[model samples]
Target: MSKKRTGVFVCHCGTNIAATVDVAKVAKEMAGEDTVAFTKEYVYMCSEPGQESVVQAIKDNKLDSVVVTCCSPNLHEKTFRDNATRAGINNFTCEIANIREQCSWVHNDKAKGTEKAIKISRSVVRRVNRNQPLDAIAVNVTRRAMVIGGGVAGIQAALDIANAGVEVVLVEKQATIGGRMLQLSETFPTLDCSQCVLSPKMVEVKRHPKIKLMTYSEVQELTGSVGNFQVKALKKPTFVDPDKCKLCDECTAVCPVVVPNEYELNLTARRAIYIPYAQAIPASFTLDESVCLGLNPIVCGKCKDVCEADAINYDMRPETVTEDVGAIVVATGFDLYGQENMGELGGGKIEDVLDGLQFERLCSASGATKGHILRPSDHTEPKNVVFIQCVGSRDPAKHCAYCSKICCMYTAKHAQLYKHHVPDGRAYVFYIDIRSGGKGYEEFVQRTMEDNDTLYLRGRVSRLYRHNGKVRVLGTDTLSGQNVEIDADMVVLALAMVPSKGTTEIAKVLKIGRDKDGFLAEAHPKLKPVESVTAGIYLAGAAQAPKDIPETVAQAGAAAAKVIALLSQATLSRPPLIARVRRSHCTGCGMCVDACPFIAIRLENGKAVVNEALCEGCGSCSATCLRAAIDVKNVTQLQIYEMIEACLAV
Candidate 1:
């Protein structure tokens, strides 16, 4: 074995390190080492001139490996690797030692910072000495993307990715493509009709040449990794053929069985065979086999008799589709916190007590009351309505601790919309604090107060019950220090927005992570807000966190851009740092099989085998191995010991 010649470069990072640590001293210390061929210090190694100098030093010193003491590898690891590659060295021969963030910024004393920087650099040098030159593994990228969920976020992502010349498969569990956005009557700030803005996008998704719309479908399994993901989606039967069915209401009119319309939040009744709403994208009806007469037609078959297109099919069964996609965008949207959880607020027992979506129905022109804004129990106008904010939110003992981000603005919007429909009606709101953090959001809240004369009380309701045929809300006004009581005709609970049902399950299936609050976890909360820890998978909308319409749309577009960027690449170059199993030292105990977090290790031919593509180099398998059969590439147990010795050395 020959001695490894390493080149070390220290970066000042424009006083980010120089102000706190001795960069030149660290470079000089590394130069004194026997393995170091040369050392250099620069103001910014990431700068063009600095990179040029590094390439020049590598060439002049005939260095086998390069070590950069600078910022985190996340920022400029690629820059130095490409620098090495340009200088006729394998890119994997380059290593990064973070001094600015890990050493200088973390320490206040100059001596301590300089000492720590030198130790870190020495560890990198030692690690580089053991590092063998390797080539990047090129994985072919499939030129297609898949989007789960059919909300505004999912629709936007699918359309954007599809328009970018990449095929997209858009899957929605519901019969229609539109999510919660379709149920709303109006959106905030501009008061634009919700469907007016969303319907066009829905139509575009259906008509787009690159998009394959799969409504009434769900992803059952996700396999493989980035650039080559295999997905199995189960598409439930809608019974009515979208291509064959005409948009006539003949079938719905002839059907005698009426069930509560879920789209209207049970505020209205629809025939057993019906479309969700008038603006449903496919313009097709779906037969509800659960409530409809029977599959055999022995009980009733009125809908089949009235169908002009003969589109009714009782034998329609669920179909499974297999899709190969390069990337995935998860925009599963959110579900409102259930009213049953708010036991203090009548527990949904009071007839007039409604959730936010139910109130949206009352204001909608197509609602059962025909936009009358009447109380559900009495079918009469509520002269005084009470709106409670954070019904199941910000209550750590009973509900969530985080604020339901959109409640304040929507609550104000609801007040304004309520006022618009009923000029004579008065609205009062109870809130801990109003969080209106968006363009024109504060102004909208102000208008609700000043223009609509909506009363704003800062507090929480302790109890709610029916009194004298009206809902009585008992709570304290914290600002005024008064125990206020209000007997309102109707009460609307601004329920907390929770991650949509099956979010955790879907995340598990995708092998992604979720936060404590059940929202999808981003790779980095601020930097990589869209990408998941799992490569090829991205997140959008309230599925990641509680966000309003504008934010959700923006995130969706950002996610689409990420997908397009991934699909545009002909082949993806993965880092050489992956796990390898030494077959000679193997004792097929299968401990690593269970200990591996990524499930990358498996027993093959009575020996432990590793799938390099699936391994993230987390070292969990290696740590669990007793015989030291597992070792991560670019890293070794000897290098770890040398690093520890370097840190402890005087």
Candidate 2:
């Protein structure tokens, strides 16, 4: 019940705060507060000497609590708290008042800004007065990691984690692990064969002892918290046993059902029993259950009969497998914007017109026309090709407002590849502006324009439609102040990259957030790009935003390193600032459980119980509790009330 000793430190932040708010006046006013035994103003409180002064004052004045009035706590809260710990005071006793972002930055009036800064500092001082010493909560770790998605990002993350001696569970929704990256003929900049670079990594994932690759599978449910998570993954049956199947083509030859091959982007037909590609991991065949004739022996038995290895199993059913892991990495990748939505362009209706991926297929050796750049409608080589960029990007009125970062570079790569295939072919590109912003990317685009003689027009295409045997492109050349028209044999649309359908579904299952554009949201865009809002969860590749291959791989490796660091810990230290339930306040209506987003609250023995490890200290449970029995540890209702009173005090 004795009076507490508090110290207040105001920072000038090199005119960031001093320019608008009078730091010296704020410090002088805080010194008059009853509990404030020490007060100081520093030019830069976050600098080494500034921090040393704070620690020295705490020691000399015997301060029990401290408040630092400066920039956002997000940037320097830990620095000041560590200083408190260094000076033998409890770290929880230190608090932050964001005078820069909340006060100075927004206001130009010096007098009003100083007045507001004083109020902010006084409010934090009141909050820190009631702050109690608390220790970090320690939770046991599972020492394993799960990576969702089987693209280059997922594969790289899994491989990196596995290489570090941590067990990995890799789940893929498709029949194979290659994802969209495998479907491309060549990558941008260097123009290396996509398969040749990625296939080796896929094979490494298949052979790695520490990695358990689960293809034709999906994560159905995720439960538990950071250091301990239970994942229920539904492994759909492929109907062809991987171990028993031979690499022979006899079964696919006899299958009667023919469907559009997804790997070929429907540019080719495939049988009911087929392998994704010759270099598919596991080297097995898959029976497309959706399009196949009834799996009954009386209905369709040709594939079973033709399989000399007897690998076909008609009675196979979906099985759910459970995995326990400490951390999870989401690398769900991306999908192109649906072509059906582009009615203004000849998309999904015109055979010769294709999206970027389909064009890559046309250039692929294993594609429908055997690497020939022939028009799909007439099966003849296209003498003229038109490439359009920003088809569904940077058009705030109708499409995505943000730029699809890879489109500009890839569009240039597409033009260069087209010219390479057909030496005499004329290539035209219609774009708003070029955004080739990577190492060697700008040079590559220049080479394509100068060496390949590809014409770059600064304009937006108005409309595209089939005219006679050729497709007519209607657009304007803004640089030339002229309207332009082209009768092209083939037109390629560089559709915007969007979060895949699976990425959306998985976000809900993982209880993570998605941005307005539907990409997974990072915890902090600059400092914590790979970390998701949820603890123990990380993001990589286009699932976060549209990015190129090199960036994707780099992010994947970074995510893997984070996982390795998390799992390597013997016990994880969670923030002690989680919710706590007051058992004496009785009624357990279970409302807190429903209101909790992280699934951190539960009713036990007809009373609310909070799992400290799972709680994010968001105060949702406390707000939903009508009895006021639940509260976050450090940010209690009493502290909030006292802080509000101090802010209102004239």
Candidate 3:
């Protein structure tokens, strides 16, 4: 047996630590430890020169392990580990002690802070002494990628990945590829027709040779790991065969079953046999099974009989398809905060008061009223329309505490569009604050107020109710310190943006995490915005957070680039820090299997086995093992005990 030599490098962090702790004394004390062969203090241990100094110290002192006591490992652990590898030592032998965030930053006394820093550094040094050098596990990759959701974000991600010479399977939960964007009339700032901008991309996705378009589909099960994932998806039957459905309107006219059209936000009626819109991708009709009489021939078969092309299939059933992919992008998009939750604002009971999406439908050219800006209650043009911003957002007590980022700009756009439709009509906007923080956004809001003569009231609406054939809005203007009331012909609520339906279910299926507000959680808020906690899966658009089209597209492109970079490699190098079972202590209680969140462990022949590819090194399995048979490599129980002893050593 050979003795281990450890080197300790303490960082001053340029007064971030030195201001509160004695860096020189801490380095001097660390040199007295048994395994520490060398110790030094630097102004910034993460700097290029500081890293060079560490490399030189390792080679000069014949050190086998290194510990860098500095900032969080998240920022510089990899840097120091790479430095160790460059100096001809195993990267696994390098460890980080977070002295700045955990010690100096939180402590006011210099003696206590320095003592805590020493304890933290000594704990990591002890752990590193016992660390065995390990190599990264390599796994072969599949060359395909799956993108969930067919919104703008998903479409852009799919196109980018496919353009990079990788195959893509694009899945949409709707009958058509276009998502919520297809239901919009026009976009903000530029005022371009939403469909006009998105239709071309929809066409491109359908015609791309490297892309497989799967509409009316949902991911049922996701298993496997990064570089090789197995996916089971359910392709829901639309009944109308897309290949044979000639976009003729005969079936819709003959159908007796009429349902509220979801595409129009239920502001209009649609036949059970109908297409989403005129320019729907795959351009076919979908038979609604939920509302239809029956799929059997004995039930009313009006749609099938009237179908001249015989596209309607009575025997259509959901088909499960399997796919193997290296990576996945989740761009499931968003849904507005339900208007039914707003009880004070009539809880969707007021006929003329509508939510933002419904207003978009009313303003759309292909909408129910043909872009007339008519009130839904009477089908007449509104004389005075009131737009309320931040309906269920930024209200911590009863609703979402976070600001819906797009609400302010969209509400301004709504007011501007209303003025465009009714030239002589009045538009009033009630808002907490105008948060037009994008390019040309502030100017657009200004233009709406100055040019269009829209009155902007700075306040929150207290109550809203229908009175005397008009929607009455009662609010207080905080800026003016006055009570304001308006009996408007129509009112629009700028509801908050929430994660689209099935976001939570999909997060559980993919083993990804979600934030407190229910959007998918990123690995890091700033550095790894698009990357999910799960290795192979990425996030974009409102599924991750509230964002507009340009931001969503940019994030989608970023996620695609990450996927491309990952799939471009012939094989992926995964961290070797995974669970390992000790066969001697075998009692295969299956407790570890039940506790493992990643499903990385399984009992094979009454012995617990670990799948290295699936394990995230979370240590949950190790914690659950009563016999202490299971442990994560490099983070074993012995190393943890030594580190804990070192920490408590006075």
Model 2 lDDT per residue over 1-650, tens place: 67889999999999999999999999999999999999999999999999999999999999999999999987899899999999999998999999999999999999999999999999999898889888878889999999999999999999999999999999999899988899989898999999999999999999999999999999999988898999999999899999999878899888999999988899889998899888898689999899889888798899999889999999999999999999999999999998887889965798888999999999998777778898989999999999999998998898889999999898899998999999999999999999988899999999999999999999999999999899999999999999999999999999999999999999999989999999999988899999999889999999999999999999999999999999999998777998989999849999999999889888999999997768878899888889989999879888888889988994
* Each prediction's whole-model lDDT (CA): 0.90, 0.93, 0.92
Q: Write model 1 residue lDDT over 489-589, tens digit each, in one string.
A: 99999999999985766897897999999999998878899999888999999999999899999999999999998888889988768888888988999
Per-model clash counts, in order, read 0, 0, 0
Q: Model 1: residues >4 Å from true position, as ranges?
A: 7-62, 68-76, 86-88, 97-125, 247-260, 269-272, 289-308, 395-398, 578-632, 636-650
TM-score of every candidate:
0.85, 0.92, 0.93
Candidate 3 differs from the real structure by a C-alpha RMSD in angstroms, to one decimal, of 2.5
Regions of model 2 farther than 4 Å from truth: 18-22, 100-116, 587-621, 648-650
Q: Model 3, poorest ten-residue lDDT window? A: 502-511
Leading candidate by lDDT? 2
Give a tens-digit lDDT track for model 3, residues 220-281: 99878899999999999999999999988999999999899998999999998899889899
Against the true structure, candidate 1 has what lDDT? 0.90
From the highest lDDT down, the ranking of the candidates is: 2, 3, 1
Which one is best on TM-score? 3
lDDT of 3 at 418: 94
- The candidate, 1 or 2, that scores higher on lDDT is 2
